[model samples]
Target: MNAKSSHPSHNLPSRRTLFTAWLVLMALTVGTMLAGHVTSTRSLGLLWTGGLLLISWAKARTILQVYLNLRAAPRGWQTGFNITLIMLLLLLLGLYAINALGLIPR
Candidate 1:
């Protein structure tokens, strides 16, 4: 309704940007699969887990900043979302570590 609110900076992403993000996500997924398949030894499996964590973190960042339109938000909101994302990812990594260490049934 307001002129300031009708600015082009608030528009949704272009088709090309979304397509490029999708392609990057697909490639990261393939990389995750490859990381899994390449792991033969226990150490390699640990390495694969780290790789998966990084891949997932990147994916989450991409989703939050692009698909969720968090990048254009105010600094506090953006920081809050990023903090939540990091905490959740850390929890996931912790669960994976526990499972890998045989603390729980796989």
Candidate 2:
């Protein structure tokens, strides 16, 4: 069985693991930038927005769980953090949808 880190405060991921995370993070960053460049109709815009939100959620969750060393934490803690991330993303998406639809004053 894998043992815990000898030093309680030393929680850095392995070099290879960190490099993998960096690659994934970079891919997500490029995906987000490309998403903004894609032209779309109003209906397609909603789908595009949803896809962007999902991708952003994935990147943020990965950063929190991997880079922040939250992956080794308890299930409850992980769930809480993930829920918080989802809620934040949902709120942001909702505001964006409203703005895109011109439902409120500019």
Candidate 3:
């Protein structure tokens, strides 16, 4: 490998980038709390639940890419991680749907 490629700073995110990512994660966290109605007794309907799930997916992606430094990984690795995350989220959503439909005993 080249000397430049071996440098630690090569794949590291800058402070500004990390700060921006932090800001985004915080915002998403607030959005999640709001969407999920953490402060209210009201239950979330399907639409709200879906929205919350989407926000959660976004937050997970941000954590994976920025905090975990997956952005610097190979394209195949990135894609694989993303696909796995998506599949897991989809499975959760599917189970929620099935429960919502009364397919399973409460």
Clashes of 1: 0
User: Can you give the TM-score per candidate against the true fold?
Assistant: 0.71, 0.74, 0.85
What is the model-wide C-alpha lDDT for candidate 2? 0.81
Which residue pairs show backbone clashes in model 2?
A: none
Q: Which 10 successive residues of model 1 have the least lDDT summed? A: 38-47
> How many clashes does each candidate structure show, in the order listed?
0, 0, 0
lDDT of 3 by residue, 1-106 (tens): 7888875447888899899999999999999998999989986876788889999899999988888898988899889999998899889888788876678886
Q: Tell me the tens digit of each residue's lDDT in model 1 across 1-106.
A: 7886876458678788888889999998888777766555545445677787788888888888778777767788878988888898788878778877778855
Pairs that collide, model 3 = none
Can you give the lDDT of residue 102 in candidate 1? 76
* Ranking of candidates on lDDT, top first: 3, 2, 1
lDDT tens digits, residues 1-106, model 2? 3365564236667889888999999999888867755554334466678778898998998898788888777789999999998999889889888877879986
- Model 2 per-residue lDDT at 14: 89
RMSD of 3: 2.5
RMSD of 1: 4.0
